[model samples]
Target: MNQNHLTTLLAVLDEGSFEGAADALRITPSAVSQRIKALESDMGRVLIRRTSPVAATDAGEILAQAARRMALLQAETDVALERSISRVPLSVAINADSLATWFQSVFSDVAKWKHATLQLRIEDEAHSLTLLRRGDCLGAVTTEATPVSGCDVRELGTMRYRPVATPALKDAFTSDEGIDWADMPVLRYGPNDAIQESDWRGRLPERPRERRVSQIPSSEAFLEAVRCGLGWAYVADLQSDPLLETGELVLLDSTHVDVPLYWQHWRLQSAMLQDLTQSVVDAAKQHLS
Candidate 1:
């Protein structure tokens, strides 16, 4: 019933596990469990199904939506009241790839401040706009060419990706030209992350795998998997550069995934949103190469 309970429930639903949810929310799993129990008791129904990967029951789905709405409202209220400072909390919905590649510069620039807090939601670019529509986020970095209704848009930059692999994987590929790198365990983004994948296919003479070898949802994990030398993957150039320099990775070819990024924010009169957008835009120009 309380906002804390709603936040905890939302965390559990977003993370899909008690431990992950607890880690994200900065609370113990026992506390998360208690919050969910209290919420279920108030709602008079079992909300989330207790399973390996947690799933929302029909009722839980309703609560999940409601919780997101409430979190937005409360966070906005807090932001509004604490607006005396030059910096304010900025909640942004962003695709994993951007967070992995370019947005880190923006985040790092803001981290030095005492008053700027960012609540980030990891989502697909294809769907990040929905969070803006629901008022759950003030800004989003998205791939959509058109701005969401009732929002302002600014081009942050474009991200380029290339097919890459470890030296061992590359050697293996070279050893047998008959071997399909596509069939090789290629780390991929969750769904529809193939903008880069398509580029890789065109760059290659032929594809061996009908589908990706592995699908990783998180940016950090995807890059880690590739670094661990478990598989080849399409990596954003901005993100791949450091790994390449460290000799931990190498590019397979010049083929690239070029995804244009746009910064979208509510068209309302929120100074914090405006400042955050400008900060990101400035950061992009410096680091999105």
Candidate 2:
């Protein structure tokens, strides 16, 4: 494969358009288009889809992932030779709740490393593996224990979420038959979030009908909304512990959700990635159950 062509393909995908890629590569838009066409001809496949903010075909993703790996290797070589080199990009997917809590330690640790730059894609823990599969991220902090193809997986730890609400909200909703599930407002991280419903199903005889739901996509905001009595939610113990201690939030029940998280990354022999994986593992041990 042509290294220049592979680099061009990655540039186009990253910039989302040929013109943008041309500008980044210090070349003409026509030159960018021609290079893409030449590369496609060589590979005998349509690697990119022509659309607004263009997307890569599956073939393109495979090559783009290869290109990213090659770039990282080159950066490492440069560092070993004591040659000037740009910081290597380390893209990883992480869940919002983790980002709001224990993952901050990873950020602090990365800040002191000068040879790498961190790029975080915040997705739900259960679904972050998709980013890794699509080559959108090099690694991910996901709830998936199964390893993705060409990747290695390690157990991080479990994050515990408690069904909690403000004291006022809990009192108003609680009754002899337990809290009024149907009428009480509930908070969720997003439509895809089912922690609240999952907990309720295990505890309740049947699913509630026409339950009121509010979506707060951000982790910090979701906790704050629950704190302000906006609605009850399965809040992470890391964030709720202080509030629970200060009497700002109370557990709605004895039930808690324990989500096991795993670290999945490509099996590569790079010192930078190894160091980063260690940092993540160390942090998870200190923070997670």
Candidate 3:
């Protein structure tokens, strides 16, 4: 396996275009194309789909991950030899709620990552594992306990979300039969978000299809919207603390949903990754439910 070609392939995947990768590497675009072609020939498979911005084929994704692990080892070796080291940014995927709540705590120690740059890709907790499977990120905070192929898994902790709304809205919706959620405005983070919907199904006898829905995509904004009586939302316990304390938000129901979080990473022996994994685990222990 040619390391240079593998590195070029990963660069193209990361940058999403040949010219973009060339600009980052300070090489000519023509040179970048040649390297990719050589790599495809060596592997006897097409590696990139030349779209508006390039995308990797399945084989390309596998090779790109291999390149990442190889680069991590090489950087470690160079540091050990007292050679000048070029830091490759470590890309990770995480859910928005985690990022909004406790994700920053992982980076509090600068001494632990002086040689690395951490890049975070945010998605919903249920969908974060897709980024890992596509090799777009090396590690992810996800709801998936099952490890992706060629990866290791660890339990971080559960994130509990309570059904909450403004005090007036909670009062208006409550009845002898419980909250009248069928006609209430429901806050959804995005189109794919099913947390609110799931909570509805578990508490009520029907689905949330007939309810009025608002798309408040930003996590912080979502909380604010719920607090302002725009609608009911399942707010993370950590994020709802201050609002609950100030009586700005009121629980619609005592029933809460617990989403179990797991850390998934490549099965590599790099010290940098090991340190990062431990930092994340420790932070989750201290902060999460």
Tens digits of lDDT, candidate 2, 154-221: 99999998888999998998889788866788898886786876766676687666777789999999
How many residue pairs in model 1 have overlapping backbones?
0
Query: How does model 3 fare in lDDT?
Result: 0.85
Per-residue accuracy of model 1 over 1-289 as CA lDDT, tens digit each? 7888887877787688989999998889999999899999999999889998898787877676566545545555665677554335477998887777667877766776556688899888878987776556778888886987778899878888777788777777664555455556667776677564565566577766475567777888888888887788788787778889988788776666677888888776655566678889997898775
Off by over 4 Å in 1: 1-89, 108-116, 175-179, 196-212
TM-scores for all candidates? 0.66, 0.93, 0.91
**Cα-based RMSD of candidate 3:** 2.2
Per-residue lDDT tens digits for candidate 3, residues 86-185, read: 6746778998889888777887753465567788998988898888988778799999999999999999999999888998988887889877878777
Between candidates 1 and 2, the lDDT winner: 2
By the lDDT metric, which is better: model 2 or model 3? 2
Q: What is the C-alpha lDDT of each candidate?
A: 0.76, 0.88, 0.85
User: What local lDDT does model 1 show for residue 276?
Assistant: 76
As a TM-score, model 2 comes out at 0.93
Candidate 2 vs candidate 3: the TM-score winner is 2
